[model samples]
Target chain A: MTAVLTTTAMPPAATAPTALRRALPLLAAPVAFFVAFFAVPMVVVLSSSLAAGGAPSLANYARVLLDQYHWDVLAVTFRIAALTTLAVTLLGYPLAYYLVRVVSSNALRRSCVILLLLPLFTSNIVRSFGWMILLGRNGLVNDTLVGIGLLERPVRFLGTEMGIVIGLVYILLPFIVLAVGNALATVDPTLEEASADLGASPFTTFWTVTFPLCLPGLIAGVIMVFTLAASAYVTPALLSGGKITVFPMLIFQQYSTVFDVHYGGALSITLLVFTLVLVALAGRIGNGGGDRS
Target chain B: MIARVVLRIVAWAVMAYLILPLVVIVGASLTATSYLAFPPQGLTLAWYGRMLADTSYVAAFGTSTALALAATAGAVLLALPAALAIARHDFPGKRTLLSLLMSPLVLPHVVLGAALLQYCAALGLMRSFAALLVGHVVIVTPFVLRSVLPQLTPEQRALEEASADLGAGPFETFLLVVLPQIRGGLTSGAIFAFISSWINVELSIFNTTAELTTIPVKLFNYVQYTIDPVIAAVSSITIAVAAVTIVLLDLTVGLHVLSNRR
Candidate 1:
């Protein structure tokens, strides 16, 4: 996830107000800039998606929603993203826990952090290229598996969904690790110690106390990963070897080659709406779970 | 404990997975053979020399660097004052405005890129450097705002007020007091912004022409057609830049990730 689940958005809170008269000037440039470049572009996309032949119509969306091929593309994209999210969370949680709580040596921890970040800081093109090479027929992954007798021969991975999932997981794993590690670091050890002192088993204490407390971060990380995985273009484009198509690729094609702004606008808005609704639903679920705990 | 041992093993394995691709890329870049090879048949830097000889690669690198620098500088300039306004004062539509600023963080870049391509085309600036820079600035601004907002604590409000009481102008107070304290956050934020712009493809893809392509996009088109030692050399260079940037960030701002904040 080059577009990552960073500590980007903090929860808004109500604070004491001292609104200055100069606040308007401070806010003017940013508001205008965001409106002109960010907000207006989005609006234009929405309008284009809604229009057909110079009138506002649902024809573009009808083409997207009424088609089986489009549905298949959506299914493949979401399936890969879901699998990537599941794999990333499972693999990343342990590393986060180990780095945060287990490693006492500062030098080793720092080195590990650097290693984790190396891929994050690199471009998706380079990273997906690494996978393209490694997942090739004679590449390291296939070579190791065959050498170890786990496989009889090299398998086709480059054009397959498995390769895409593997690449997506690798790209997204660091986000989960960083997110969960941040959450784990902030947990009060005394609470866990108190639970153990009160005769709780380690497993019981972790399930009852620690996990719930970190659920919000876990959920946030999960949302970030899923959205990014769902909307990913570059990795799937490269790793899929043109044998697979994701939602974003469809959008890319419409705008880049087809020159169909109406159709591309519909696809863009469709992806945007789905992603936002999913995030809001996940946020609601996370909050409800937190309240119950 | 056995549990601890297993966790350590898993952690080390994951770390290895993270490093393996990078090692492969760097290793493959040096293969004396014409094709890519790991544990390279023999070490040579001929690919690096070849890549350097290609002026297109040189030009792309320059373009990417200049674009990232301009985008980052623009983000910091735009975001700092907004962060100050949001953190230091209360106003109407503040929450709405804040969400708008942060929306790009979650919004898919492909969608944004498509929108920009369409929008900029209407404005007759399609596929220009300005189009790419605006999109980059829009996306990177949120990062700087997020990082800097946390640094503008309420306790600093008193310091700022005292500066104002001493007849220090608003710009002077910002320079001497506000800037000094938030330097760490600003540095990390700017680094993140620069890297994000540097590495972006989905948005940059729409606005880039063959004459003004970024390094990532160049490597992208080249990689799709051929996987050669030269592409590996270019990728390795990007990885080296990343490693150097992270190390620099850690030394300067103390990345201090996964560490408890007391």
Candidate 2:
């Protein structure tokens, strides 16, 4: 299969100069487009962040970093992101494992996968709107809880951290499922079978063999969920109901309402850098896990 | 065995959790009441009718459709060549270029939106369709690139070379041989790109005006100020569109995503 694949997929061997020249025409349009639109816009934001009062200054950074309000918002944002990632991983891992390793019916698994992708494909606004109605004071969730004696009265979900986390997890859960599902699918089941036949318990086999293999995918999903939950604007905006604020919301406020590009630029860069650093750390951790066991 | 049973129960519950909100929105949209309700007070299409009666809703839908179509087309045009280059030839900065294209997937759309707003304002094109198109293209191109790159394998290259050696020109070879091979990837990628552009809020919010808003951004703005059956109706329409797209996607490409097949 590998040899067949290579023969079918690989380009004809060509000299480096000729291949570079041939590839140039194809690369030109996309490279130019990204440089103009993506790269240049990012550069503009970076420059704006570094300048204030028509001079290059760190005032915007100081304002963003030194302010207590910003720190509070960052704490809320990161906390929500961290919690969302954890919740998604907990919920998603089992579903992925069931789908990949346990489920016997192909049709069932496909339907479940479709169900997973539907919410992902749908707009966050729409999904969050759904949650808003369901979580309202007299909504079905509260009604059911009260009816079942789970609560004495309707509990507030809107305008709270828990509400934000719920919405973010719902929006992000599919990433974890897909990532870990694909990873699970690639693991050789025979290894687990061998461990079992060699007198290891199922739990021991999983912890010693199966779990380590899928760590990369789990980490990828965790990073994706974290980044997405951290930067999520629409879900947090709707679910928070103006009572909670995340980092992206602050950035949006500065640009959309305050029209303070310098401050917003600083906020944008701060969020971007923070997300990048977390992602890097997660990658390192994932690699470390891969190296161990 | 007990653990397996537990896993099964948890999986089903998670599936329900995954689907409950969408079911509620679709249900609430049919409520006869002026306010939104699930297990809807009474079934009625009146809210959907009211939505249809509004010209702004109709216009926003039209604008969103046009923008998504344009962006998808632009992404396909730009990304296909880039995919071809990356798959067919090794070049300097190939890894960097691929990451640059795909970075939008991970970058915060809010930041991108704000950056575009600032950049376009500097370029004298703020809040225009052009500005929206460029931003949408930048973001959605990666979808097309990712999907198409994997389809361009060495075996496919051999077929293309065979067509060329048989005296077919580059364009003809691409049209007949290469296009057919990557049709699945390209179609799926284009659909994904279309939907991503269509349903985008954060990115579109920055460039959109009251006159030229997309459906998702419009819905975002409306849902903030009010929660009514009409809003639910609008949400349901988008939900229906998403449902249809997914169904079409499943039928066409076979969403065997969880299959343990290599």
lDDT of each: 0.89, 0.91
Q: Interface Cα RMSD per model, in Å?
A: 6.4, 4.2
Name the 10 consecutive residues with the lowest summed lDDT in model 2 chain A: A1-10
Candidate with maximal DockQ = 2
TM-score (C-alpha, index-matched) for candidate 2: 0.96
Candidate 1 stretches with Cα past 4 Å from truth are: A1-21
Candidate 1 residue lDDT tens string, B180-218: 999998999999999999999888999999999999999
Model 2 per-residue lDDT tens digits across residues B1-262: 9999999999999999999999999999998888887899989999888999999999999999999999999999999989988887777778999999999999999999999999999999999999999999999999999899999997988788788678776677788999999998998999999999989999999999999899999999999998898998898899888889999888887785778887
Report the number of clashing residue pairs per model. 1, 8
Candidate 2 Cα outliers beyond 4 Å, as residue runs: A1-17
- Candidate 1, residues A206-247, lDDT tens digits: the string is 889988988978998999999999999999999998999999
Candidate 2 residue pairs in clash (backbone atoms < 3 Å): A7-B155, A8-B154, A8-B155, A8-B156, A9-B153, A9-B154, A9-B155, A10-B154
Docking class of 2: medium
